[model samples]
Target: MFLNTWSLWEKEPDYNSYLGLAENLDEKGYAVSFGDNPFDDDKVGEKVYMHILNRADKYVHIITPYLILDDGLLMALKYFAERGIDTKLILPGIPDKKAVYALAETYFRTLLNSGVEIYLYTPGFVHAKVFVSDDKKAVVGTINLDYRSLYHHFESGTYLYGAKCITDIEADYQATLSKCEKVTYESIKKEKAFVKLRGRFMRLIAPLL
Candidate 1:
Protein backbone atom coordinates (compact mmCIF):
# COMPACT_ATOMS: atom_id res chain seq x y z
CA MET A 1 0.00 0.00 0.00
CA PHE A 2 1.06 3.58 -0.73
CA LEU A 3 0.03 6.90 0.78
CA ASN A 4 -1.18 9.52 -1.68
CA THR A 5 -0.62 13.22 -1.28
CA TRP A 6 -1.07 16.26 -3.50
CA SER A 7 0.90 19.48 -3.30
CA LEU A 8 -0.65 22.55 -4.89
CA TRP A 9 1.04 25.92 -5.55
CA GLU A 10 -0.68 29.27 -5.67
CA LYS A 11 0.23 32.91 -6.27
CA GLU A 12 -2.28 34.02 -3.66
CA PRO A 13 -1.10 34.49 -0.10
CA ASP A 14 -4.28 33.09 1.40
CA TYR A 15 -3.82 29.57 2.75
CA ASN A 16 -7.57 28.90 2.76
CA SER A 17 -8.09 30.01 -0.82
CA TYR A 18 -6.10 27.41 -2.69
CA LEU A 19 -7.91 25.20 -5.20
CA GLY A 20 -10.66 22.90 -3.87
CA LEU A 21 -9.54 19.34 -4.65
CA ALA A 22 -10.91 17.19 -1.84
CA GLU A 23 -14.10 16.05 -3.51
CA ASN A 24 -12.33 15.38 -6.78
CA LEU A 25 -9.73 12.85 -5.79
CA ASP A 26 -9.87 9.09 -5.99
CA GLU A 27 -7.62 6.07 -5.40
CA LYS A 28 -6.06 6.24 -8.86
CA GLY A 29 -5.18 9.94 -8.55
CA TYR A 30 -2.09 11.11 -6.72
CA ALA A 31 -0.17 14.16 -5.67
CA VAL A 32 1.52 16.54 -8.09
CA SER A 33 4.87 17.98 -6.99
CA PHE A 34 5.63 21.46 -5.72
CA GLY A 35 8.74 23.78 -5.54
CA ASP A 36 11.11 25.52 -7.95
CA ASN A 37 13.82 24.68 -10.46
CA PRO A 38 16.14 27.62 -9.92
CA PHE A 39 18.73 26.71 -12.52
CA ASP A 40 16.52 26.80 -15.57
CA ASP A 41 14.24 29.24 -17.35
CA ASP A 42 10.53 28.72 -16.61
CA LYS A 43 9.87 25.96 -19.12
CA VAL A 44 6.70 24.98 -17.27
CA GLY A 45 4.62 27.45 -19.25
CA GLU A 46 5.72 26.05 -22.60
CA LYS A 47 5.69 22.39 -21.66
CA VAL A 48 2.41 22.31 -19.70
CA TYR A 49 0.34 23.34 -22.66
CA MET A 50 2.55 21.68 -25.24
CA HIS A 51 1.96 18.28 -23.70
CA ILE A 52 -1.46 18.55 -22.03
CA LEU A 53 -3.40 21.27 -23.78
CA ASN A 54 -2.24 20.40 -27.31
CA ARG A 55 -3.85 17.00 -26.98
CA ALA A 56 -7.30 18.23 -25.94
CA ASP A 57 -10.15 17.53 -28.30
CA LYS A 58 -12.67 19.64 -26.35
CA TYR A 59 -11.22 22.82 -24.85
CA VAL A 60 -8.18 24.45 -23.30
CA HIS A 61 -9.05 26.78 -20.44
CA ILE A 62 -6.90 29.36 -18.66
CA ILE A 63 -7.64 31.61 -15.69
CA THR A 64 -5.11 34.24 -14.72
CA PRO A 65 -5.18 37.81 -13.50
CA TYR A 66 -2.43 39.08 -15.76
CA LEU A 67 -1.33 37.83 -19.18
CA ILE A 68 1.57 38.51 -21.55
CA LEU A 69 2.02 35.79 -24.13
CA ASP A 70 5.51 35.32 -25.54
CA ASP A 71 6.20 34.23 -29.12
CA GLY A 72 6.54 30.52 -28.47
CA LEU A 73 3.47 30.15 -26.25
CA LEU A 74 1.51 32.45 -28.51
CA MET A 75 2.41 30.37 -31.53
CA ALA A 76 1.52 27.19 -29.70
CA LEU A 77 -1.90 28.61 -28.85
CA LYS A 78 -2.48 29.59 -32.46
CA TYR A 79 -1.48 26.13 -33.57
CA PHE A 80 -3.91 24.54 -31.12
CA ALA A 81 -6.71 26.85 -32.18
CA GLU A 82 -6.10 26.17 -35.87
CA ARG A 83 -6.55 22.52 -35.20
CA GLY A 84 -10.05 23.27 -33.76
CA ILE A 85 -9.16 23.28 -30.09
CA ASP A 86 -11.28 25.77 -28.18
CA THR A 87 -8.61 27.81 -26.47
CA LYS A 88 -10.18 30.25 -24.04
CA LEU A 89 -8.70 32.78 -21.62
CA ILE A 90 -10.10 34.41 -18.48
CA LEU A 91 -8.19 37.47 -17.24
CA PRO A 92 -8.70 40.12 -14.60
CA GLY A 93 -10.97 42.99 -15.41
CA ILE A 94 -9.45 44.91 -12.52
CA PRO A 95 -5.72 44.29 -12.28
CA ASP A 96 -3.51 45.14 -9.35
CA LYS A 97 -0.91 46.66 -11.69
CA LYS A 98 -2.16 49.00 -14.35
CA ALA A 99 1.08 48.82 -16.29
CA VAL A 100 0.82 45.05 -16.64
CA TYR A 101 -2.78 45.37 -17.68
CA ALA A 102 -1.82 47.93 -20.27
CA LEU A 103 0.87 45.63 -21.61
CA ALA A 104 -1.56 42.73 -21.73
CA GLU A 105 -4.12 44.79 -23.61
CA THR A 106 -1.78 45.49 -26.50
CA TYR A 107 -1.88 41.85 -27.51
CA PHE A 108 -5.66 41.56 -27.39
CA ARG A 109 -6.22 42.24 -31.03
CA THR A 110 -3.59 39.80 -32.16
CA LEU A 111 -4.96 37.02 -29.98
CA LEU A 112 -8.58 37.68 -30.89
CA ASN A 113 -7.72 37.69 -34.57
CA SER A 114 -5.83 34.46 -34.17
CA GLY A 115 -8.99 32.81 -32.81
CA VAL A 116 -8.28 32.78 -29.07
CA GLU A 117 -11.32 33.62 -26.97
CA ILE A 118 -10.56 36.23 -24.27
CA TYR A 119 -12.68 36.99 -21.21
CA LEU A 120 -12.21 39.66 -18.57
CA TYR A 121 -13.26 38.81 -15.00
CA THR A 122 -15.48 41.71 -14.05
CA PRO A 123 -15.82 41.55 -10.24
CA GLY A 124 -12.18 41.68 -9.15
CA PHE A 125 -8.59 40.71 -9.87
CA VAL A 126 -8.10 36.97 -10.52
CA HIS A 127 -4.53 36.01 -9.61
CA ALA A 128 -4.91 32.27 -9.86
CA LYS A 129 -2.69 30.63 -12.49
CA VAL A 130 -4.62 27.59 -13.58
CA PHE A 131 -4.95 25.60 -16.80
CA VAL A 132 -7.42 22.83 -17.63
CA SER A 133 -8.03 20.81 -20.77
CA ASP A 134 -10.88 18.51 -21.78
CA ASP A 135 -11.68 17.93 -18.09
CA LYS A 136 -9.04 15.21 -18.25
CA LYS A 137 -5.93 17.12 -17.22
CA ALA A 138 -4.95 20.27 -15.34
CA VAL A 139 -1.95 22.29 -14.22
CA VAL A 140 -2.37 24.35 -11.06
CA GLY A 141 0.47 26.43 -9.73
CA THR A 142 2.42 29.65 -9.92
CA ILE A 143 3.17 29.77 -13.66
CA ASN A 144 1.98 32.81 -15.60
CA LEU A 145 1.82 33.40 -19.34
CA ASP A 146 4.37 36.18 -19.48
CA TYR A 147 8.06 36.67 -20.14
CA ARG A 148 9.00 37.14 -16.49
CA SER A 149 7.09 34.06 -15.35
CA LEU A 150 8.17 31.91 -18.27
CA TYR A 151 11.79 33.09 -18.60
CA HIS A 152 12.89 34.60 -15.31
CA HIS A 153 10.90 33.63 -12.22
CA PHE A 154 11.53 30.34 -10.44
CA GLU A 155 8.01 28.99 -10.69
CA SER A 156 6.26 25.61 -10.60
CA GLY A 157 2.80 23.97 -10.93
CA THR A 158 1.24 20.61 -10.24
CA TYR A 159 0.26 18.59 -13.28
CA LEU A 160 -2.75 16.34 -12.67
CA TYR A 161 -4.19 13.53 -14.75
CA GLY A 162 -7.56 11.82 -14.35
CA ALA A 163 -8.41 14.01 -11.41
CA LYS A 164 -11.99 14.91 -10.56
CA CYS A 165 -10.91 18.46 -9.75
CA ILE A 166 -10.44 18.97 -13.47
CA THR A 167 -14.22 19.35 -13.59
CA ASP A 168 -14.14 21.63 -10.58
CA ILE A 169 -11.72 23.87 -12.43
CA GLU A 170 -14.08 23.90 -15.38
CA ALA A 171 -17.02 24.65 -13.15
CA ASP A 172 -15.11 27.59 -11.74
CA TYR A 173 -14.46 28.68 -15.28
CA GLN A 174 -18.18 28.60 -16.09
CA ALA A 175 -19.01 30.58 -12.96
CA THR A 176 -16.42 33.14 -14.04
CA LEU A 177 -17.97 33.41 -17.47
CA SER A 178 -21.05 35.01 -15.96
CA LYS A 179 -18.89 37.80 -14.56
CA CYS A 180 -16.74 38.29 -17.65
CA GLU A 181 -16.75 40.60 -20.62
CA LYS A 182 -15.61 39.15 -23.90
CA VAL A 183 -12.86 40.90 -25.86
CA THR A 184 -13.13 41.62 -29.56
CA TYR A 185 -11.05 43.24 -32.29
CA GLU A 186 -13.35 46.25 -32.36
CA SER A 187 -13.06 46.60 -28.61
CA ILE A 188 -9.29 46.53 -28.89
CA LYS A 189 -9.40 49.13 -31.62
CA LYS A 190 -11.80 51.25 -29.63
CA GLU A 191 -9.44 51.70 -26.71
CA LYS A 192 -8.26 55.32 -26.31
CA ALA A 193 -5.01 56.31 -27.98
CA PHE A 194 -3.34 57.23 -24.71
CA VAL A 195 -4.16 53.80 -23.28
CA LYS A 196 -2.87 52.14 -26.41
CA LEU A 197 0.33 54.17 -26.19
CA ARG A 198 0.72 53.13 -22.56
CA GLY A 199 0.30 49.52 -23.63
CA ARG A 200 3.11 49.92 -26.17
CA PHE A 201 5.40 51.46 -23.56
CA MET A 202 4.56 48.72 -21.11
CA ARG A 203 5.25 46.11 -23.77
CA LEU A 204 8.79 47.50 -24.13
CA ILE A 205 9.40 47.12 -20.41
CA ALA A 206 7.40 43.91 -19.89
CA PRO A 207 10.41 41.64 -19.40
CA LEU A 208 11.16 43.50 -16.19
CA LEU A 209 7.65 43.10 -14.78
Candidate 2:
Protein backbone atom coordinates (compact mmCIF):
# COMPACT_ATOMS: atom_id res chain seq x y z
CA MET A 1 0.00 0.00 0.00
CA PHE A 2 2.80 2.39 0.86
CA LEU A 3 4.54 1.60 -2.41
CA ASN A 4 1.33 2.28 -4.30
CA THR A 5 0.96 5.66 -2.63
CA TRP A 6 4.54 6.57 -3.26
CA SER A 7 4.21 5.71 -6.90
CA LEU A 8 1.09 7.82 -7.17
CA TRP A 9 2.85 10.90 -5.91
CA GLU A 10 3.75 12.96 -8.95
CA LYS A 11 5.24 16.09 -7.36
CA GLU A 12 8.39 15.89 -5.27
CA PRO A 13 8.37 12.10 -5.49
CA ASP A 14 10.09 10.43 -2.55
CA TYR A 15 10.37 6.66 -2.94
CA ASN A 16 12.91 6.18 -0.18
CA SER A 17 10.63 7.75 2.45
CA TYR A 18 7.86 5.25 1.75
CA LEU A 19 10.34 2.37 1.43
CA GLY A 20 11.80 3.21 4.83
CA LEU A 21 8.39 3.06 6.46
CA ALA A 22 7.52 -0.17 4.66
CA GLU A 23 10.72 -1.80 5.89
CA ASN A 24 9.75 -1.29 9.54
CA LEU A 25 6.42 -3.14 9.40
CA ASP A 26 6.73 -6.87 10.06
CA GLU A 27 4.49 -9.46 8.37
CA LYS A 28 1.79 -11.11 10.51
CA GLY A 29 -0.14 -14.38 10.38
CA TYR A 30 -3.56 -12.95 9.50
CA ALA A 31 -4.68 -13.61 5.93
CA VAL A 32 -5.01 -10.08 4.62
CA SER A 33 -4.75 -8.75 1.07
CA PHE A 34 -4.64 -5.14 -0.07
CA GLY A 35 -6.36 -3.85 -3.15
CA ASP A 36 -5.70 -0.47 -4.73
CA ASN A 37 -6.65 1.25 -7.93
CA PRO A 38 -4.57 2.98 -10.69
CA PHE A 39 -1.33 1.69 -9.24
CA ASP A 40 -2.27 -1.94 -9.70
CA ASP A 41 -5.13 -1.42 -12.14
CA ASP A 42 -8.33 0.58 -12.27
CA LYS A 43 -10.33 -2.55 -11.52
CA VAL A 44 -8.36 -3.79 -8.54
CA GLY A 45 -10.93 -2.70 -6.01
CA GLU A 46 -13.81 -3.84 -8.16
CA LYS A 47 -12.22 -7.27 -8.62
CA VAL A 48 -11.80 -7.64 -4.88
CA TYR A 49 -15.46 -6.85 -4.28
CA MET A 50 -16.62 -9.19 -7.04
CA HIS A 51 -14.39 -12.01 -5.82
CA ILE A 52 -15.77 -11.73 -2.29
CA LEU A 53 -19.37 -11.58 -3.44
CA ASN A 54 -18.96 -14.56 -5.74
CA ARG A 55 -17.39 -16.65 -2.99
CA ALA A 56 -19.91 -15.80 -0.29
CA ASP A 57 -22.06 -18.77 0.70
CA LYS A 58 -24.08 -17.60 3.66
CA TYR A 59 -24.49 -13.82 3.62
CA VAL A 60 -23.07 -10.50 2.52
CA HIS A 61 -23.69 -7.24 4.35
CA ILE A 62 -22.41 -3.96 2.92
CA ILE A 63 -22.28 -0.34 4.06
CA THR A 64 -21.56 2.22 1.39
CA PRO A 65 -22.30 5.92 1.04
CA TYR A 66 -22.96 5.78 -2.68
CA LEU A 67 -24.40 3.18 -5.06
CA ILE A 68 -23.73 3.65 -8.77
CA LEU A 69 -22.92 0.19 -10.06
CA ASP A 70 -21.78 -1.05 -13.46
CA ASP A 71 -23.36 -4.01 -15.21
CA GLY A 72 -20.94 -6.60 -13.85
CA LEU A 73 -21.33 -5.69 -10.17
CA LEU A 74 -25.03 -5.06 -10.54
CA MET A 75 -25.54 -8.50 -12.01
CA ALA A 76 -23.35 -10.23 -9.46
CA LEU A 77 -25.25 -8.68 -6.56
CA LYS A 78 -28.61 -9.44 -8.08
CA TYR A 79 -27.63 -13.03 -8.82
CA PHE A 80 -26.57 -13.63 -5.23
CA ALA A 81 -29.72 -12.09 -3.83
CA GLU A 82 -31.89 -14.00 -6.26
CA ARG A 83 -30.20 -17.21 -5.19
CA GLY A 84 -31.41 -16.56 -1.61
CA ILE A 85 -28.08 -15.54 -0.21
CA ASP A 86 -28.56 -13.07 2.63
CA THR A 87 -27.71 -9.93 0.66
CA LYS A 88 -28.07 -6.61 2.40
CA LEU A 89 -26.85 -3.02 1.91
CA ILE A 90 -26.82 -0.03 4.22
CA LEU A 91 -26.90 3.46 2.72
CA PRO A 92 -27.03 6.95 4.12
CA GLY A 93 -30.34 8.56 5.06
CA ILE A 94 -28.93 12.09 5.42
CA PRO A 95 -26.88 12.44 2.31
CA ASP A 96 -23.65 14.33 2.11
CA LYS A 97 -24.28 14.81 -1.61
CA LYS A 98 -27.90 15.09 -2.64
CA ALA A 99 -27.32 14.54 -6.37
CA VAL A 100 -25.32 11.38 -5.75
CA TYR A 101 -27.90 10.17 -3.29
CA ALA A 102 -30.62 10.66 -5.85
CA LEU A 103 -28.64 8.66 -8.36
CA ALA A 104 -28.24 5.91 -5.80
CA GLU A 105 -31.98 5.83 -5.20
CA THR A 106 -32.45 4.95 -8.85
CA TYR A 107 -31.12 1.46 -8.11
CA PHE A 108 -33.46 0.70 -5.23
CA ARG A 109 -36.30 -0.78 -7.20
CA THR A 110 -34.14 -3.12 -9.23
CA LEU A 111 -32.22 -4.35 -6.20
CA LEU A 112 -35.35 -4.70 -4.08
CA ASN A 113 -36.99 -6.76 -6.79
CA SER A 114 -33.98 -9.03 -6.82
CA GLY A 115 -34.44 -9.73 -3.09
CA VAL A 116 -31.53 -7.59 -1.93
CA GLU A 117 -32.41 -5.88 1.37
CA ILE A 118 -31.77 -2.15 1.68
CA TYR A 119 -31.42 -0.07 4.83
CA LEU A 120 -31.05 3.64 5.39
CA TYR A 121 -29.32 5.07 8.43
CA THR A 122 -32.03 7.28 9.82
CA PRO A 123 -30.03 9.12 12.47
CA GLY A 124 -27.57 10.70 10.04
CA PHE A 125 -25.21 10.06 7.14
CA VAL A 126 -23.44 6.69 6.91
CA HIS A 127 -19.97 7.27 5.46
CA ALA A 128 -18.62 3.83 6.20
CA LYS A 129 -17.36 1.72 3.27
CA VAL A 130 -17.45 -1.85 4.52
CA PHE A 131 -18.36 -5.31 3.23
CA VAL A 132 -18.64 -8.25 5.61
CA SER A 133 -19.73 -11.71 4.56
CA ASP A 134 -20.23 -15.19 6.04
CA ASP A 135 -18.58 -14.17 9.32
CA LYS A 136 -15.27 -15.15 7.72
CA LYS A 137 -14.49 -12.45 5.19
CA ALA A 138 -14.66 -8.67 5.34
CA VAL A 139 -13.29 -5.58 3.61
CA VAL A 140 -12.74 -2.20 5.26
CA GLY A 141 -11.64 0.70 3.15
CA THR A 142 -12.19 3.93 1.23
CA ILE A 143 -13.84 2.35 -1.78
CA ASN A 144 -17.50 3.32 -2.18
CA LEU A 145 -19.90 1.21 -4.21
CA ASP A 146 -19.90 3.85 -6.91
CA TYR A 147 -18.39 4.22 -10.36
CA ARG A 148 -16.15 7.05 -9.28
CA SER A 149 -14.51 5.00 -6.58
CA LEU A 150 -14.41 1.77 -8.50
CA TYR A 151 -13.00 3.07 -11.77
CA HIS A 152 -11.83 6.65 -11.45
CA HIS A 153 -10.36 7.25 -8.03
CA PHE A 154 -7.22 6.06 -6.27
CA GLU A 155 -8.91 3.91 -3.65
CA SER A 156 -7.63 1.12 -1.44
CA GLY A 157 -9.01 -1.56 0.89
CA THR A 158 -7.87 -4.44 3.05
CA TYR A 159 -9.52 -7.79 2.35
CA LEU A 160 -9.61 -9.93 5.47
CA TYR A 161 -10.03 -13.72 5.40
CA GLY A 162 -10.56 -15.66 8.61
CA ALA A 163 -9.39 -12.68 10.56
CA LYS A 164 -10.56 -12.18 14.13
CA CYS A 165 -11.50 -8.63 13.22
CA ILE A 166 -14.23 -9.96 10.94
CA THR A 167 -16.38 -10.63 14.00
CA ASP A 168 -15.94 -7.07 15.24
CA ILE A 169 -16.74 -5.73 11.79
CA GLU A 170 -19.95 -7.74 11.60
CA ALA A 171 -20.80 -6.68 15.13
CA ASP A 172 -20.43 -3.05 14.16
CA TYR A 173 -22.60 -3.66 11.12
CA GLN A 174 -25.35 -5.15 13.31
CA ALA A 175 -25.11 -2.27 15.77
CA THR A 176 -25.42 0.16 12.90
CA LEU A 177 -28.25 -1.84 11.42
CA SER A 178 -30.26 -1.34 14.60
CA LYS A 179 -30.19 2.39 13.87
CA CYS A 180 -31.28 2.00 10.24
CA GLU A 181 -34.72 1.84 8.67
CA LYS A 182 -35.23 -1.02 6.26
CA VAL A 183 -36.44 0.01 2.81
CA THR A 184 -39.38 -1.89 1.39
CA TYR A 185 -41.11 -2.11 -1.95
CA GLU A 186 -43.95 -0.07 -0.53
CA SER A 187 -41.50 2.62 0.51
CA ILE A 188 -40.01 2.78 -2.97
CA LYS A 189 -43.45 3.08 -4.47
CA LYS A 190 -44.17 5.93 -2.10
CA GLU A 191 -41.06 7.93 -3.05
CA LYS A 192 -41.86 11.35 -4.42
CA ALA A 193 -42.24 11.54 -8.20
CA PHE A 194 -39.84 14.46 -8.46
CA VAL A 195 -37.18 12.55 -6.54
CA LYS A 196 -37.55 9.62 -8.87
CA LEU A 197 -37.25 11.84 -11.91
CA ARG A 198 -34.17 13.51 -10.50
CA GLY A 199 -32.58 10.13 -9.87
CA ARG A 200 -33.34 9.02 -13.42
CA PHE A 201 -31.69 12.14 -14.77
CA MET A 202 -28.69 11.66 -12.52
CA ARG A 203 -28.10 8.20 -13.97
CA LEU A 204 -27.20 9.72 -17.31
CA ILE A 205 -24.08 11.29 -15.82
CA ALA A 206 -23.32 8.76 -13.08
CA PRO A 207 -19.86 7.98 -14.41
CA LEU A 208 -18.70 11.52 -13.63
CA LEU A 209 -19.88 11.42 -10.04
Candidate 3:
Protein backbone atom coordinates (compact mmCIF):
# COMPACT_ATOMS: atom_id res chain seq x y z
CA MET A 1 0.00 0.00 0.00
CA PHE A 2 2.80 2.41 0.84
CA LEU A 3 4.57 1.57 -2.39
CA ASN A 4 1.39 2.24 -4.36
CA THR A 5 0.97 5.64 -2.73
CA TRP A 6 4.64 6.48 -3.21
CA SER A 7 4.35 5.85 -6.92
CA LEU A 8 1.56 8.46 -7.07
CA TRP A 9 3.60 11.29 -5.43
CA GLU A 10 7.08 10.57 -6.77
CA LYS A 11 8.01 11.21 -10.37
CA GLU A 12 9.78 7.86 -10.33
CA PRO A 13 9.38 5.48 -7.43
CA ASP A 14 11.95 2.76 -6.83
CA TYR A 15 10.22 -0.54 -5.96
CA ASN A 16 13.49 -1.99 -4.63
CA SER A 17 13.53 0.58 -1.82
CA TYR A 18 10.91 -1.44 0.10
CA LEU A 19 12.02 -4.93 -0.82
CA GLY A 20 12.43 -7.72 1.76
CA LEU A 21 10.61 -5.73 4.46
CA ALA A 22 8.23 -8.65 5.08
CA GLU A 23 10.70 -11.51 4.65
CA ASN A 24 10.66 -12.41 8.35
CA LEU A 25 7.10 -11.31 9.10
CA ASP A 26 4.68 -14.24 9.42
CA GLU A 27 1.40 -13.71 7.54
CA LYS A 28 0.12 -17.27 7.53
CA GLY A 29 -2.76 -16.83 9.96
CA TYR A 30 -3.68 -13.34 8.72
CA ALA A 31 -6.34 -13.24 6.01
CA VAL A 32 -6.39 -9.48 5.67
CA SER A 33 -6.14 -8.26 2.07
CA PHE A 34 -5.39 -4.71 0.99
CA GLY A 35 -5.91 -3.03 -2.37
CA ASP A 36 -5.54 0.47 -3.86
CA ASN A 37 -6.85 2.28 -6.91
CA PRO A 38 -6.18 4.24 -10.13
CA PHE A 39 -5.12 0.98 -11.66
CA ASP A 40 -4.18 1.46 -15.33
CA ASP A 41 -6.11 -1.44 -16.82
CA ASP A 42 -7.94 -3.03 -13.90
CA LYS A 43 -10.28 -1.57 -11.28
CA VAL A 44 -9.12 -3.63 -8.35
CA GLY A 45 -11.46 -2.13 -5.76
CA GLU A 46 -14.55 -2.81 -7.88
CA LYS A 47 -13.29 -6.28 -8.68
CA VAL A 48 -12.85 -7.03 -4.98
CA TYR A 49 -16.48 -6.07 -4.36
CA MET A 50 -17.71 -8.19 -7.25
CA HIS A 51 -15.65 -11.10 -6.04
CA ILE A 52 -17.19 -10.92 -2.60
CA LEU A 53 -20.69 -10.70 -3.99
CA ASN A 54 -20.09 -13.62 -6.30
CA ARG A 55 -18.65 -15.79 -3.57
CA ALA A 56 -21.16 -14.99 -0.86
CA ASP A 57 -23.11 -18.04 0.32
CA LYS A 58 -25.60 -16.88 2.91
CA TYR A 59 -25.79 -13.08 3.09
CA VAL A 60 -24.18 -9.77 2.15
CA HIS A 61 -24.67 -6.54 4.06
CA ILE A 62 -23.49 -3.12 2.91
CA ILE A 63 -23.31 0.37 4.35
CA THR A 64 -22.37 3.13 1.97
CA PRO A 65 -23.11 6.85 1.74
CA TYR A 66 -23.57 6.90 -2.01
CA LEU A 67 -25.42 4.41 -4.22
CA ILE A 68 -24.85 5.50 -7.79
CA LEU A 69 -24.05 2.13 -9.33
CA ASP A 70 -22.96 1.09 -12.78
CA ASP A 71 -24.85 -1.63 -14.62
CA GLY A 72 -22.50 -4.39 -13.53
CA LEU A 73 -22.74 -3.63 -9.82
CA LEU A 74 -26.42 -2.87 -10.06
CA MET A 75 -27.03 -6.22 -11.67
CA ALA A 76 -24.80 -7.97 -9.21
CA LEU A 77 -26.70 -6.63 -6.21
CA LYS A 78 -30.03 -7.50 -7.82
CA TYR A 79 -28.85 -10.95 -8.74
CA PHE A 80 -27.68 -11.67 -5.23
CA ALA A 81 -31.03 -10.70 -3.78
CA GLU A 82 -32.99 -12.49 -6.44
CA ARG A 83 -31.14 -15.63 -5.59
CA GLY A 84 -32.19 -15.28 -1.93
CA ILE A 85 -28.85 -14.31 -0.42
CA ASP A 86 -30.35 -11.95 2.16
CA THR A 87 -28.76 -8.92 0.50
CA LYS A 88 -29.28 -5.59 2.17
CA LEU A 89 -27.98 -2.02 1.80
CA ILE A 90 -28.06 0.75 4.37
CA LEU A 91 -27.90 4.32 3.04
CA PRO A 92 -28.27 7.68 4.70
CA GLY A 93 -31.67 9.24 5.13
CA ILE A 94 -30.15 12.58 6.06
CA PRO A 95 -27.88 13.28 3.14
CA ASP A 96 -24.96 15.66 3.16
CA LYS A 97 -25.47 16.29 -0.52
CA LYS A 98 -29.05 16.45 -1.70
CA ALA A 99 -28.15 16.15 -5.37
CA VAL A 100 -26.20 13.02 -4.88
CA TYR A 101 -28.88 11.65 -2.61
CA ALA A 102 -31.45 12.19 -5.28
CA LEU A 103 -29.25 10.43 -7.75
CA ALA A 104 -28.92 7.54 -5.39
CA GLU A 105 -32.68 7.25 -5.12
CA THR A 106 -32.87 6.51 -8.82
CA TYR A 107 -31.67 3.01 -8.10
CA PHE A 108 -34.11 2.20 -5.31
CA ARG A 109 -36.93 1.02 -7.54
CA THR A 110 -34.95 -1.54 -9.44
CA LEU A 111 -33.15 -2.71 -6.30
CA LEU A 112 -36.34 -3.05 -4.25
CA ASN A 113 -38.14 -4.81 -7.04
CA SER A 114 -35.36 -7.32 -7.23
CA GLY A 115 -35.97 -8.14 -3.51
CA VAL A 116 -32.82 -6.38 -2.32
CA GLU A 117 -33.66 -4.71 0.97
CA ILE A 118 -33.01 -0.97 1.24
CA TYR A 119 -32.82 0.93 4.49
CA LEU A 120 -32.39 4.62 5.28
CA TYR A 121 -30.71 5.75 8.48
CA THR A 122 -33.18 8.18 10.04
CA PRO A 123 -30.99 9.89 12.59
CA GLY A 124 -28.15 11.59 10.69
CA PHE A 125 -25.80 11.04 7.79
CA VAL A 126 -24.27 7.58 7.28
CA HIS A 127 -20.74 7.80 5.93
CA ALA A 128 -19.72 4.22 6.57
CA LYS A 129 -18.14 2.26 3.71
CA VAL A 130 -18.48 -1.34 4.73
CA PHE A 131 -19.32 -4.76 3.32
CA VAL A 132 -19.78 -7.88 5.40
CA SER A 133 -20.69 -11.23 3.93
CA ASP A 134 -21.66 -14.68 5.21
CA ASP A 135 -20.21 -14.03 8.70
CA LYS A 136 -16.80 -15.01 7.35
CA LYS A 137 -15.63 -12.12 5.18
CA ALA A 138 -15.83 -8.36 5.25
CA VAL A 139 -14.37 -5.12 3.86
CA VAL A 140 -14.04 -1.79 5.59
CA GLY A 141 -12.55 1.22 3.89
CA THR A 142 -12.95 4.26 1.63
CA ILE A 143 -14.60 2.57 -1.30
CA ASN A 144 -18.15 3.79 -2.13
CA LEU A 145 -20.71 2.08 -4.36
CA ASP A 146 -20.39 4.76 -7.01
CA TYR A 147 -18.53 5.45 -10.20
CA ARG A 148 -16.13 7.99 -8.74
CA SER A 149 -14.83 5.70 -6.01
CA LEU A 150 -14.83 2.64 -8.23
CA TYR A 151 -13.28 4.21 -11.33
CA HIS A 152 -11.77 7.66 -10.78
CA HIS A 153 -10.35 8.34 -7.34
CA PHE A 154 -7.43 6.80 -5.48
CA GLU A 155 -9.07 4.48 -2.96
CA SER A 156 -8.13 1.59 -0.68
CA GLY A 157 -9.80 -1.10 1.48
CA THR A 158 -8.92 -3.92 3.84
CA TYR A 159 -10.57 -7.25 3.11
CA LEU A 160 -10.90 -9.58 6.05
CA TYR A 161 -11.56 -13.31 5.91
CA GLY A 162 -12.48 -15.20 9.06
CA ALA A 163 -11.36 -12.24 11.14
CA LYS A 164 -12.78 -11.73 14.61
CA CYS A 165 -13.49 -8.07 13.83
CA ILE A 166 -15.91 -9.14 11.11
CA THR A 167 -18.36 -10.25 13.75
CA ASP A 168 -18.29 -6.79 15.31
CA ILE A 169 -18.69 -5.19 11.89
CA GLU A 170 -21.75 -7.27 11.13
CA ALA A 171 -23.13 -6.53 14.57
CA ASP A 172 -22.76 -2.82 13.93
CA TYR A 173 -24.60 -3.21 10.65
CA GLN A 174 -27.48 -4.93 12.45
CA ALA A 175 -27.58 -2.15 15.05
CA THR A 176 -27.65 0.44 12.32
CA LEU A 177 -30.41 -1.41 10.56
CA SER A 178 -32.61 -0.94 13.59
CA LYS A 179 -32.33 2.82 13.17
CA CYS A 180 -33.23 2.65 9.49
CA GLU A 181 -36.62 2.85 7.81
CA LYS A 182 -37.13 0.23 5.19
CA VAL A 183 -37.95 1.59 1.77
CA THR A 184 -40.80 -0.05 -0.06
CA TYR A 185 -42.27 0.51 -3.50
CA GLU A 186 -44.95 2.69 -1.94
CA SER A 187 -42.39 4.92 -0.30
CA ILE A 188 -40.62 5.39 -3.60
CA LYS A 189 -43.87 6.47 -5.19
CA LYS A 190 -44.27 9.19 -2.58
CA GLU A 191 -41.11 11.00 -3.67
CA LYS A 192 -41.65 14.52 -4.94
CA ALA A 193 -41.83 15.02 -8.69
CA PHE A 194 -38.98 17.52 -8.65
CA VAL A 195 -36.68 15.11 -6.83
CA LYS A 196 -37.42 12.40 -9.36
CA LEU A 197 -36.65 14.78 -12.20
CA ARG A 198 -33.36 15.78 -10.59
CA GLY A 199 -32.47 12.13 -10.12
CA ARG A 200 -33.13 11.45 -13.78
CA PHE A 201 -30.85 14.31 -14.81
CA MET A 202 -28.15 13.18 -12.41
CA ARG A 203 -28.32 9.61 -13.65
CA LEU A 204 -27.27 10.72 -17.11
CA ILE A 205 -24.00 12.12 -15.73
CA ALA A 206 -23.51 9.58 -12.96
CA PRO A 207 -20.21 8.38 -14.37
CA LEU A 208 -18.68 11.83 -13.74
CA LEU A 209 -19.84 11.76 -10.11
Strongest candidate by TM-score: 3
Superposed on all Cα atoms, the candidates' RMSDs to the truth, in angstroms, are 7.5, 7.2, 6.4
Error of 1 at 131 (Å): 0.3
The number of the candidate with the highest lDDT is 3
lDDT string for model 1 (6-110, tens) is 332332123223365544544544345544554664365556556665567888998877788777777878778778889999999888988789889987777
How well does candidate 3 score on lDDT at residue 188? 95
How are the candidates ranked when ordered by TM-score, highest leading?
3, 2, 1
On the 0 to 100 scale, the lDDT of residue 30 in model 1 is 38
- Kindly report which residue stretches of model 2 are placed more than 4 angstroms away from their true locations once superposed: 1-35, 39-42
Location of the lowest summed lDDT over 10 successive residues in candidate 1:
1-10
Cα deviation in Å at residue 136, candidate 1? 0.4
Model 3, span 1-209: residue lDDT tens? 22232122112223234564534434421244456667575787887788789888899999999999999999999999999999999999899999999999999999988999999999989999999998877888899999889999888877766557788999999999999999999999999999999999999999999
Evaluated against the true structure, the overall lDDT of model 3 is 0.83
The local lDDT score (0 to 100) that residue 58 gets in candidate 1 is 80
Q: How would you encode candidate 2's per-residue C-alpha lDDT over 71-101 as one tens digit per residue?
A: 8999999999999999999999899988788
Candidates' C-alpha lDDT: 0.75, 0.82, 0.83
- Model 2, position 109, has a per-residue lDDT of 85
